[model samples]
Target: MPGGVGYLLQHCGAFFIRRVWGDDLLYNSIMKEYIEILLLRGHNIEAFTEGTRSRIGKLLQPKFGIMKIILEAVLSGRVKDCMIVPMSIGYDRVIETGSYVNELLGVPKEKESLYQLLSNMNILSLKWGRIDISFNKAFSLKEYIGAHTTRRGIPLNPSTSKIDRDLLLQSLGYRILSDINKVSVIMPTALVGTILLTLRGRGVGHDELVRKIEWLKKGIEMRGGSAADFGGKSTGWVVDRAIQVLKDLIGQRTDLLEPVYYPVKRFELSYYRNQVIHLFINEAILSCALYATVKQGGPIHVQRVKINPDLERDCSFVSKLLKSEFIYGPNGLTENMMKSIEDLTSLDVMRIDVENGTDGEVKYLSLSAEERRIGRETFDFFCFLLWPFLETYWLAAISCFALIPQTLPPIEPTWVDERVFLDKAQFLGKTLYYEGDLSYFEAVNKETLKNGFQRLKEMGVILFRKVKKGNENVTMVALSLDWCPKTALPKPPKCSKTGKGSEEVKSNNTIFTSIFGGGKPEPKISLDGTDTPQDYFDETWRYFVPEGKLWELCEQIGRYRREGKNRRDTATVAARVLSLASVTGALLTESDGTGWIKKKTSKL
Candidate 1:
């Protein structure tokens, strides 16, 4: 905040909190006193539990600093009972969508300033559709604590110990967030974005888009979630309105609707989709579990399928894998899976059977002929809701392997800067997408990659260490000491300058020359250049260089340019080499009059 915003906030009884407070005994004391005084004086205090707005449109984990201060004030008898209200606000069109997309694509967020704020004021003229706001019923903080601890037969009181107080704070934080999520209004834009992003291919029929939107709305409502009501407007009208409002991202082509700038614009749409993603997380987990079971040779088919006893395990595994991406209920993974199963059963998409076994009654889940048909039809839709996240995790995992050295016995603890690791993961994601290996383009998101990295760290698959890089401390990621790949890692593709026969090169010489204009033959260097063996890059002089070798090539190019080589010819050759190698966004330029190839931060 800048200019009058800070002044206005202060005048409105808002107190600023420092993110980094060094030796803040006095600051903390004053803050605690001010909060307690406000509570005792019967002043309503509104605090954002998450501390800041989430760039991805989902609820971020709560920050406990202010919450801790407030709770201590109430629990220590400094203040009487206080009411906690969970508030959720949803937007049909976010004004900051472009900036959010930019940040997700690796661009650093711009600091707030008066000039920037004024320059962006033109957004007020845009038709942003509906802004749905919901505030859940307030609850007494003391009663909430008592209710939570009553079942454990250990009541939380003013004299509760530090451990109990901390535990209560943690639970209370999540409980408030869960309530906020529960009451979040699913705007039409959110529904439309979710459907469009989940659907395969670039184009969708107008009728088909509307149909899916309707189906998604019904499904969300069935899950006890509410979609924004447009005064009894028809589903088609809602679709049209959403399409109109999001026209910048989505284009209408006669009877077809397609994303305007695919892959890039998908990130923008994902921001809206993420708003309602939590409502579908359980179903997505169940869908993934079914797929995992099938991949493991379980009896699964279109007509009918018998659920394996390991279904629960599979669901828990999938949920744990996505634990960082979504918030799950406190009822535990198994309990959540059971609830999803019950929901599906109620919808007649599946059924359960109780049978007597040696260990008493056992329950088995199964899908009948008709139910299996319905399940199959809906399975892909549910899976689509989570496919982007899975793709992000998969890319993150592959980048870990990609970062490791290619050797007989792999490097023990290969480490890379966290920023570089994310960049590589995003680059590989785009490469895979262009090569048709990855389907979901939005998986190249930075936030999702960060979440995946966090989840991997939590799972002990990777370790994070801080190392000084220049003036700043950078986080370095490495494989955990105890972690081992289940299968042997693949060796890096070998490269050779003369590996491709001259005859083969001659055969494709015309096509290659036409694509990249023929230039004077370059003098051979002492560098060990290797030919790419992949069919995608079969042309001679083009190679698939690994990350380590890629940098060497950049240095080689720089050296050649320094030797007074033709700038156009040098850049042309470099571009062709990197393009075939699938590093599309890299730019070869003269930085400070020194020829250097630098990669520009971009999304796929």
Candidate 2:
């Protein structure tokens, strides 16, 4: 797969992987046999420590299932003291990013097939850029166990203690993840993506972008990070190459008679941008906080202009705020922020003073002439990076306020399901997205939405409880303010019955719209007089009625399309309807199969 030989070796003549799916239960037994064969037969075994492909572009928290088995074998003396090595492989662009985005949005990932396998072979010809493979430090299992077994609170023999064994495996797994992050490479695609996106769709001219690239090269170099494909080249040359690559994927346009990226391509642009977000996110965050203090007239903005941030407090605040939006290594913000401060100091953007006291108060100062010029161009970049998350937080706060009644009354948190709250947040988030209040890609993200809820919870805006619903217990939230039981527990909007009585409440808008277009329609009319195709699309979704089958939904779409005169664009109409449904927190797959359904908009 790495070298693209899978396309040529159609019959798997010499190259083939014995796949062990992470989702399957019975595969555990197969995996055990596979491992035993490799260990005992003196064969090398390669495994993805992440257990599954990363859907969010960053390394997900490692699953301990496979790691536990491997550790068990070593502890049982089934294999000799094996050398454990951590390796990381990164691509400038991944082939599965589009499908990954869908899966992350809660769509069921389609099962892989032979036809799909052959279809993906087309990626071999694409300009995917370079592959970076980095090998990290190796450690032996014997040495690892020997060093960890005698920890103060751990038992002497892990075999006799399940808790001790589990802890040891978890610690080892985290170590491997840390090693993986250390070796990850930075690619030009990610660099370019970050630069363009930082502009927030306000396209930058060629000369200006090249200058920004030079500034980034210096910043990255100061942090001792590698930029792939940038070896020994002038910044202008590298920027030109990167822009050409982006143009190949998303066509270019001229804005104000200067070469600029197409703004509408930001979604695709964000994917590549996210690939390198981890490397400099902490630095960007620190810069923002300091700059905000200076701009907003704090002690830092005073005559001396040396900033003193409550290191632990400010860093943790920013980290929690951006946790969902950015991918970070295992290190906490405290440690990472300190490192960032040091990097910025070296870059001459900050300074640390120890002469006044031993605490080493950090000071922020205006950049040098050249540096100030760079900062001016990139100031909005920092603003764009943090704007969406701040908007999400405000949206969540508004939702909580709207849910609560004005009069004070005591109420428990168990009335509202946490899952339902998240659903509502995303649905309303899309509303805000359409209103131009939320970023395009961040609007539908579940994790970011969850972070918004969490931030509100921490701020005492909402309190939560665990409530038993059906066979499972769900986390529920309620306003921390006074509760009026009658109105506090809101239900889904009561949809009136229309059109067919016996069959579902599907609408026949042709006659109603034809008649109503020339006159005022009744208030209770299913098809509003001013309704356009978009309004109809929004209204038809309510017929989903919380849940239904995929085929049944398709049939409903067919009925709706048949009512209209435009039959030529059925496929496009069908896809748009379904996509809108998904974004609005209405459509989802059935638990056990390929069937699809809609989720309730509010509690009932």
Candidate 3:
């Protein structure tokens, strides 16, 4: 469709591309020249849709320039019988992924020779699927016009027909889609790879993967694929061919095994896997926003349990950056973002290991300003415009039920969904309790996500169970690994600054929460010496876990301390127990077990 617009003079249509490569303005200029030529040659003017392709698999939002022209022209009687057709072309081997990654990384691609380009084709074999073109039944302009040609035409800028403009775009977009059947290489590979990754974490055999893929291809084929569209020499053959190409690459390199489907190109699997994840992520974003809108709740904010007691030191840096922008005041209107978020039942708060590589496969790894802006914008649109009849509102509530609070692992997809912490009901009698698990919050690749999970285990926030879904499970959403520690020291102060004066209040946020903004997802840390977030609490310690151990020691010595034992002996034992609870805090009293730990340690 991209080059087609460049070549087709008589059949002019809109050009949609991603906002990448700022040459879109030039593309419009070239199109206008070609269109003017065709009109001068007495050919019917084929109007253009000035739009861009989305880098992601979903359709890009259309620009209104072309739509404006079509409306003006049709109303002015500049054209007739403006029949439009929507066509889809699916690629079994997406030529763009290779090019796309290059573009994303700011890598400039060199145009290669015919042989070099062919060698890079990676089509060692391929299964090119048939193109799906939806021929929308044409409608006469008169039907929509609903008005006989007047000396003076209906006003295109009429104030009374504002809703009509929206209705026209929506109706036309869907009508055009009714004719498309093409599946691009990105879509199918994502479908197949996502399934395989889900089922076999290490990967799957080619034959077995193909069987599963065949079932899907065949099913879709039966639904709408004609004999030529698939089956013999069409989409099916192309898909089969694509898989075959992957299998054929086995003998070409020693590193490639007979069953190996890829050469392990640096970003291919990641790019494809991202395509798969984004499908669900996009849906999750849309649905969750809608769910939040109808529920009528306040904005959801999250906090992480602080392992480091150092207040004011580490957070001093983050606090500088931690700011809340008042984009606009909350109102009950469609554009009121805060109010829209307020309507949501819950927020998807995933607990990721910002300290580990938990989120590698995901493309954008951080909670950047751009992402936050998009998130707020998306919430606003869905809450205000989404049809109320849809189950988007209901589904949000149902999803929360799947999350068991406290024990949830903070995986990426788990984010944006409200997390419920499980109660420590089972440990009520045991005054001393301690537990931890690794929770990845950063977006990373498969390797990073795994590494992040393992490392997070060392840092704590551990959960006892794991839940996974789908075939390949690459898109597997994990619980945020929420947990509750028994408060051994029930009367302890609500907040304690590590190494600070006894009267100083610890800030509300902690080192981990401050470093990565608590509401964000798990972090993806790299093992290759990159992305190691500076740890402010690395040397500091929290008393929660340590206090738990102290409680048991207190119970063990309760009788001894209360007995008519020697005062010196009782003080010695009490000092030691209390010493175990102190972390970098200056010794206030001197005792071991019962007394003198502070005086002895300080003297040493």
Candidate 4:
């Protein structure tokens, strides 16, 4: 069977991408044993059955390549007692299923690609399931293949009977060699499907997830399927068995059973759940169908169609169209069409609703008689273009969102690094720093937001659908590109205001500034403002400082602001002023009168 043993070996064959066909690696002396093994085994004819990946428990409809090759061998009279017995060998676990799932989804692997190579290195393999090998009864080839070679189980000669051919193929499809219910797939799939479905759309807490899992055991029993059947654990034990399998698969923590108070482990639960998600489609079509609904989410938007004269006709038109398509388009208040419309109300996508009134005796309510419009796209026209495209991409979009954590290029410097300059990027759940912060430039907030849009578009995170909040705060600012090698955390600045970070700066301020400044001579301020490059000095200084306060000083003040909340202390103000004078020599000299700028002080 394709999904059986043939599928497992085919998976092995598929790993050697691009080295097949004309490549000598397979047929040549390089991997001669590998090729010989195939020929020696009845599977030597070498045709990969596509349907094996899905919809079957064993080898599927045989393709012509293997049959034709065998026929040629028979024609040349090289075959004597050729008996083909197809065997299905299921593994305890598929080691490299992350790739396997992709293949099933119609994304064939191109092994020659560099990105895939890098991706493979990082992939955490989920452990295999128990091996279940079912061998089909052997078939003799002499009578069938001697004179008239039957390909695809259909005889070629005009005199040959079609009825006989059909029976032969049907036997090949349905004959059970040795079926193993112990490792049959339905259990693993059903167990996982139940777990995920119970997850609903939100992540449950550890305690709650456990309780719900226990609840599922009873529910599954009530539903006429054993909760532990696919997973093949004792009754009410699937959860433990699954976790065990996952723990074994990951090979990270061997001690999985050590008090798993949570349904899954703290850090590793996501990985286990994701493994289930990987096989979601292949396991069961009903499960996949549930996933389809979950993929779309609750509803798009809910429109209350008022049953009116002209509007009724429009509603009927929409209802008829929706009904034809099998989307729930019931006439009353509870139609799925209205529910879909309701889903859009929360997320800020563009949409419109219209209403009109009539005289009291014949008055009624309904949707707009005129077609719904968004700029130029009518509602019907929009759904017409939208439905099929959404149907295709909706799964992709869900997986995109679900797999966001899995695929995220590991943030090079995870924490806020001074060298990296993005001190904090994540707050709560959403990304904290806007892309403009990384771009670092002097631009209007709008331009910064626009830059953020471009960068995020490249990142392919969320779309630029709508900006609900923080649009003003988000801006493009070139993050400090200057590097500071971290030998250790800097000592605190001795200054009254600055924190520990300022000490390193104060000790080697001149040397450090010179190195980073690239020999740009420090302005020689005369207090007279003569040839001072005060413009350059002031700009660079202003770039570093804000409102004449050094960045470090501002940081200290921020700390005080957080802890103190009120500047109620009198001495604190005076000490800070004196400390500023000590740091800035300009405070000591009288103003030259060229531009008299008085510095604030705690004038005691």
lDDT of each prediction vs. the true structure? 0.64, 0.54, 0.31, 0.29
Over the stretch 334-394, how does candidate 1's per-residue lDDT look in tens digits? Answer: 7788888888888776677777778777676655456556545576667777777777776
Could you tell me which 10 consecutive residues in candidate 3 have the lowest summed lDDT? 429-438
Candidate 4: clashing residue pairs, number: 37
**Stretches of model 2 off by over 4 angstroms after superposition:** 1-37, 104-111, 119-123, 147-159, 230-237, 248-251, 254-257, 288-311, 320-335, 351-423, 447-604
For residues 1-604, what per-residue lDDT tens digits would candidate 4 score against the true structure?
Answer: 2235556666776423232244455444434444334555655343343223422122223433234444334334554445555545444334544444333223345454445555776445544445445544556655644333344454443224455444443333232221212122333423432343333122434344456556544533432323223444443354455545555332223255433232332112222222222121111211121122222334323333233443334433323322211122113423533343443233222233444435444332212333232321222212222122122221111111111111123222111111111111111001101211111111111211232324323334333222112342121211111211112111111222222222111222343243234454332222211111111122222223122112222222222111112222233332332222222222121122223233311111
TM-score, cand. 4: 0.29
Error of 1 at 215 (Å): 2.9
Model 4 misplacement above 4 A? 1-18, 22-68, 71-81, 92-130, 136-190, 201-233, 248-604
1-604 per-residue lDDT for model 2 (tens digits): 5345566664553434345354566767777766765677776557678777765556655667656767877888887667778898877777776676665454566877667778878778877667889888998876788788865454567666888888788778777876776667767777777787776335777787787777766656655566675678877787667666666445456645877654445655666765555566776666555544344333432512343444445446666655545556556666777787776667555655443546654544443344455554444455455554455554554445334432235333223456545555555555445534344545456655566677656755567666556776566666655322232221112223244322232323332233223344422322211111132333433433322232232232222111112222234343343333333222111112222233221232
Per-residue error (Å), model 1, residue 385: 0.7
Candidate 2 positional error at 577, Å: 25
Candidate 4 lDDT trough over 10 residues, lowest sum: 423-432
TM-scores of all predicted structures: 0.75, 0.64, 0.37, 0.29
Instruction: Give me the candidate number with maximum TM-score.
Output: 1
CA deviation > 4 Å runs, candidate 3:
1-50, 105-163, 174-191, 197-200, 218-240, 246-531, 538-604
TM-score of decoy 3: 0.37
